[model samples]
Target: MDGLFTYNPAMVKAALGTHMVTGYAEDTFITIEEISQGTTSKTGCDGETVRSVDPNTRFSVKLTLQMGSPTHKYLLNRYNRDKKDGNGSFPILINDLTGKEKFSAINAWVTKLPTNTKGKEGQNKEWTLETGQADFQIE
Candidate 1:
């Protein structure tokens, strides 16, 4: 138990929650726990000069999911089903593993699903789901 020579252990956190998409199935469950990063618009933004900053700008979040999972399948199903019906915002919650009473979001919707399917055999099929919100909560 020599602290000075041991590497620090990782701080792991599971992301599991539900969000309303197209009202196809109220409270669609995102059942995956091997999350790596939960990020926001701050992930790649620079501080503005004091004189040019706009305080009214809204920040968004992007959630990435591996392909072939139930969550991915459900979202893909929704996307294929309702994408032609016009896009709209819905509530979302990126919560703890229990899928209840955790983080909360209002008026959010996926803005992009960049298909960067490259490699000789169509590898790298991960999906990036970007959503925007006017309000967010984590408790």
Candidate 2:
């Protein structure tokens, strides 16, 4: 077989709660980041070194949506509700249909509302979600 690969944006699916985000921004629509747990190794007084592992899995998922998109509105509503009462935590999932890559968070919450920027042309709204533990896989 030849060494060729293909990628499609339409095959990438992302969902927040019960809503599946489709109206994404122009470029770099969604991004999943893994937050560093902690230092895995340390040096001792002599020439000895000690190693430790952190089992915490933290993640930050950023979703950039087109201005005035339905998903954006939904996120805004969630933000408002969460701000009023501390009861807005949902699961998030991002899966790529073209491959065996998936990212998910069992317990996630919106960090805050995206910044508002207005001009002649509308700007994109970026929403950030944080999770204490997340499952991430790429292949």
Candidate 3:
């Protein structure tokens, strides 16, 4: 059965590649923007009231971090260095906190990490898949 459920925002956990952001250890991370598990879409025919089974799943994460943090520097360097590498992809893990779960994109890259920010805000880091889904599990 499907029904609405309540979740705790503080339990949202994330990691980049092999880094853990759950604060369970020395290496931890956080996001200021809203985080989602992902989204799905299906192919459709023109003028047809039905949808096909071509699923399009992409997980796009956007968050702001303090301008001068160590993470900010590392992500900035990584983004600027590999923006043009066609084969570059960054693995990410996002846990909803009920259990330990992980997923890596089929193909992924850092899309945005601006150097500027709002009057008193921080920088944003966002990643979106190029040609695959973001729901693959890690064992």
Candidate 4:
């Protein structure tokens, strides 16, 4: 309406299959990146330019969670399942209740497990997932 808007991290919801993700890391919670693997443009000797599109819709999502959290355990289980049998692909969805931002992926899998470091305190675990195609919108 006017210049009054509210935002809260708790309003945002993220899920992988039936598991709801929570216990996000304090530093950075989540990040999504679109992977581009095609060509952009090429210029010829004269003044002609060739433009092309890759039409690649691949994307990746990174989620940082508290170590030993339930979310981390869920992802670890999925990763183990995938490594064992290769049937661990699942759907992912992220929705921002404060705004109209949303991200959805029909097919996604964990790229790799998070590295562990032993220190005085428990560190955060970062889980990375790659998707064949992802539908994302921000406004």
Query: TM-score for each prediction?
Result: 0.42, 0.90, 0.53, 0.91
Whole-model lDDT, model 4: 0.89
Q: Can you give the lDDT of residue 66 in candidate 4?
A: 84
| Residue lDDT tens for model 4, 7-36 | 888888999999999999887798988887
Q: In angstroms, what RMSD does candidate 3 have relative to the true structure?
A: 7.2
lDDT of 2 by residue, 62-121 (tens): 999888789877777777888989777788889988876899888788899889999999
Q: How close is candidate 2 to the true structure, as a TM-score?
A: 0.90
Q: Where is model 4 more than 4 Å wrong at Cα?
A: 37-39
Residue 17 C-alpha lDDT in model 1 = 31
Local accuracy of candidate 3 as per-residue lDDT tens digits, 1-139? 5866665645666666654433222122333221343344554576545434434556555434444445554555556667665444656666666434455554455676554645655444332323245674523
Q: Arrange candidates by lDDT, descending.
A: 4, 2, 3, 1
lDDT winner, 1 or 4: 4
lDDT of each: 0.39, 0.85, 0.49, 0.89
Off by over 4 Å in 1: 1-57, 96-103, 116-126, 136-139
For model 2, what is the error of residue 8's alpha carbon versus the real structure, in angstroms, after optimal superposition? 0.5
Q: Top model by TM-score, which number?
A: 4
Report the C-alpha lDDT of model 1 over 11-114, residue by residue, as the tens digit.
Answer: 11223235322211122223222122333234224664333333332444444443333555555554554477754445555544332224444544445564
Model 2 accuracy (lDDT, Cα): 0.85
The alpha-carbon root-mean-square deviation between model 1 and the true structure, to one decimal in Å, is 10.7
C-alpha positional error of residue 11 in candidate 4 after TM-score superposition, expressed in Å: 1.1
